[model samples]
Target: MPSLQALKRSARYELIRAGLEGTALALNFGLPLTNPQRGVIFALHHVDPESPANWAPNAWLSITPTFLEQAIEVCKEEGLIPIALEDLPERLADPQDTRRYVCFTLDDGYRDNARFAAPVFQRHAVPYTIFITSGFVERTRSIWWKTAQDLVMRTDDVDLSTFGIDTRVNIEQRAERVALFDRLANAVNDAENEDTAIARLDSLAAAHGIDPLAITEHLTMNARELAELAADPLAHFGAHTLTHANLTKVDDKRLETEMVQSAARVGGYVGAKPTTFAYPYGYASAVGAREIAAARQAGFVAAVTTRPGLLSETSGKAATALPRVSLNGFYQRKRYVRALLSGLPFRLRQT
Candidate 1:
């Protein structure tokens, strides 16, 4: 028998699909505007289906293989040009050129990236950047979203009161619960210790009477796969962090180690110093002025955060602390493409 939570999730999926379909229809028939002067930088994570199913929900943020191809076509038809991260500093220096642009970036360096997404980029001649977690690539036990999923699905009847997580959701109210799960995922990502976060998941499972390790078996990507992907021309590597820690929670020295070590390790594998960095859980609270400075000191040419905005001529030359619009699962609607390029809104939201 399906659990109430499972049944609710099924219904929520239906609602989400309906909403997306409606949004797509509106984009195709209702909102058609031109912004010849603007471009967007898109963010992606988890490239393959082999990711721990529980830990990495495909619906959380992923493009179907078909959507990936279609998005490329749409960009070309709409007169958008896709550029590499390395070229962004140059292009943003001149956003008035009136050539539509899109810079594609993948974060977290999952092994499935090489297996799934790299070929798509290569065939399309698209240039991309892959930001990696050095600790995981270098053989350290780490917590990733997939591992978190393992904690969720494997554990049943778990309690999370100690972690301040609320798991009381009936099937009819699951949309809200799943949304809360998303926030909890972010909270876990922001936690200082990977172990603590894992434990919290375990506790959540214990509260629900499920096994904690259900998904850990499928969460990791292999080192050989990462090395192979690093050698590709269409792809470049960047630093996410040593252990994927939220830089703001740690002290300066630890932050430095995470940043510098991650860059060094990834650079060694990719045969080039990682020139780009993306703050783990990149946001105002997860990252700050100090963290940006630290990335620069670590020798990254530019850094990106989860802030929603496009780069402009006056945005400054500190590529190490560059801002980016997060292109997650919810941003699939084509209207978002326009929203991302519209600099006026971000600048307005800034104040």
Candidate 2:
């Protein structure tokens, strides 16, 4: 059975989809009267086409190589030039460069980013950023969300009574599996020690005869692959914390450690300090003035959040707390991509 939260989320997704469709139509017909003049930064995760089949509930996080290609093509068609995040300062400052710009950012340092997404961006000669979670690269932490999904898929059932879930989920049912995954993900997020939370889930999966760590061995880029990616001139590295923990939940010292250590670790691998940072979870709850100040203090040139809005001149003022438009899985159509870049939807929200 779908959890009430899942049901509500689905409803909200549908409503947002409808609004995006309408907004796309309006922009296409020039009904919005004005468009966003600023550049855009798109946030993405897991660009593989195959992984979504195994985890249906989180499919939104993965976009196919084809969709990525289409999205890039749309960006070109709409007269937007691709720029690297590092180039933003100069681009924004230049009075002569009139072309609107877009930057692509993929979080989580997924292996498929190199295997699939890189070639696509390379073909277009576009520069992009990959934010790495140091713990993930070190293989000291498992991606709990992926582990939770794998646990439900591989096991016949899951007992959740200990986690305050009243029922035993029948994993064979897709809806039940999704609900269980959601509950587990929430638990992991709320956990004081996210690594401990993931370890608990791993134990649960082990009891059911699955090794969650083994399952995720290929999910994220290993050290060697990261080194190779960092060698690419078009590719830039950014710190995404050490364990992908929610910054808002950790104490001041731990939060600073996560940010500073991650930058140092990536710097070690890439042979230079990472100039950018991406807050784990990236929402307002996960990041705020406190976290932003910490990132700046840690020496990041800028930090980005998962906030939905177009970039503007004023955006540069809040460099460490910048917003990004997620090219979400729910809206992969090229038209929707154009709509998002149009900035019409964000403009409408403001009024």
Candidate 3:
């Protein structure tokens, strides 16, 4: 884990790099620079803080309910109108429609999204989208991160020699545990195959008496829970692919299966065919031209990437793979989020 001073310095550096100081002026003046006429899709994951400690390695995947509510208020205060992701294609296509819109999209169907985040959206009457990973709802895939987290927290020591570690590792201290989780994550991402990498993690977790799928069962909403939440008029559903696989690493057939079947599965639960999609892991390494093309081939009208950019006019030209700004869990402050929505940092040369 990073020390308080180190974390503060890193946060300050990011704010400066984002040109956050000028964001206030841009917003106050109603500069075109701060406008969201082409819209900004904010990528999010967990809205409920599952772990309160500083030792949480996946802390970036979560934000407090207070922060979620504050974020909604801040967006409205900054002159961005809340719109459903389903409306994005039409809004982007209309050259005459100049209204600035903010589309809140949460990836991975966490139960907290329905339990915690939904109430905030309901109270404010803001529209948002939840991208369901069907395997998670069905508890069929190993959510390696969550599994690793529990194993590290529960066990004082672990042996991963079979997974490339030369010796047993100890995680007595909080920082050591956090570091261990990060190391496990890096090993997976750096592996030749994502599933093979995950299999290794699963085996390691099982050796330590952890059931990876059970972690998924505990963390995510099931099919019935998803259906109940889908009943909310403010809540819209999108497909996030089955098993949340690294699309780039999988074969073409696997890619098509994940996309098409996941969308179909989510539609079955949500009672509406999902027209929009969110790529799993949504990064360049995970989702590329091939994955984006597959999303279009799967019949989605719009799909979002984790690529950090405010949507612009020409963005509509590529409706299938639109850029999105992550409401990163690391930077949950209203000020940082405000700067992101302004479209200034990306426009700045330093970025």
Candidate 4:
């Protein structure tokens, strides 16, 4: 059974989606009623077309390569100039500049980013930032979500008793698989020791006939690939913590270690310390004043949350708590992209 909070969130998202679709025409052409600022930071995860079928439990986290290409083209067509993340401060500082800008940021340093997405970005000559979790690149930590999904999809029955999850699930059923993944993923996210929870999950996955580490090794960039990506002029590396741990749950010492060590490791690959940071599982509860202060102390120039809103002059002041709109998998249509970038949906929601 889905938690009440999860159900409520799903309902809220559906309402927002309906609003975006309903007000698409007015938003695209009408005078802007929201913030006058003309810049957007897009957050994305997986960018490869792993399956032809678009419907999946984790579909929202991914967009096909074709969709990515079309999105960039749509932005260009709509007169939104592609700008590097590093250039955003300068652009935001210039109040006189009237041109719209978009900055691309891909989280998790997925291997597919290098294999599939990078080529598309390169062809379009767009600059992007890839936030890497050092432990993921070092293979010292596993992507719990991926491991959970694989276990749920591969086995008809799973014994999650070890994780204190006493739920009956038939993985063969799509709905059950999604629900199971949600429960397990949420548990991992809220766990006190996320690393231990993930390690235990990996053990369960191995016992059920799959090596989670081996499977996910190909999903994220390795140290060598990170170095290569950092060398690309179109690409910039950012810290996403050492283990992708939620900073809010850890003590001050551990929190600093996660932030500082991750930046240092990426610095080794990029030849300079990363100036940007993306909070792991970036949500309000996962990050707050403490995390923001830590990012500043770690010497990050900017930090972005998964919050949905447009960037404005005021946002420049709150660089550490900056908002970004996800190029969500559910809203894949080009018109939807225009509506989101318009800042109208978020504005109307506020009203």
What Cα-based lDDT does every candidate model obtain? 0.65, 0.82, 0.82, 0.81
Write one digit per residue (lDDT tens) for candidate 3, span 218-263. Answer: 8899989988998899999999889888888889999999989998
Which regions of candidate 1 are displaced past 4 Å? 1-38, 48-58, 94-100, 159-195, 198-217, 316-318, 331-351
Give the per-residue lDDT digits (tens) of candidate 4, residues 133-179.
98888888878888887888779988766666674445666667767
Best by TM-score: 2
Badly placed stretches (over 4 Å) of model 2 are 51-55, 93-99, 161-167, 348-351
Which parts of model 4 have CA positions greater than 4 angstroms off? 1-13, 28-34, 51-55, 94-99, 167-169
Worst 10 residues of 1 by lDDT: 49-58
The deviation in Å at residue 225 for candidate 3 is 0.4
Candidate with better TM-score, 3 vs 4: 4
| Residues 1-351, model 1: lDDT tens digits | 344555676676565445445545555675554433456667777554432333234455555444455566666666678887877766666645545567788877665567777888888998888888876665564454554444444433334566675644332233434444555576676667755875676566545554433332234444566677767878888888877777787888899998888888877777787878899878788888899888778777678887766755444376766667655454455554444454444544557
Q: How many residue pairs clash in each candidate?
A: 22, 0, 0, 0
Clashing pairs in 2: none
Candidate 1 yields a Cα-based lDDT of 0.65
**Residue ranges of candidate 3 with Cα displaced over 4 Å:** 1-37, 49-51, 349-351
Candidate 4 is scored at a TM of 0.91
In order of TM-score, best first, we have 2, 4, 3, 1
> What RMSD does each model have against the real structure?
5.6, 2.2, 3.0, 2.4
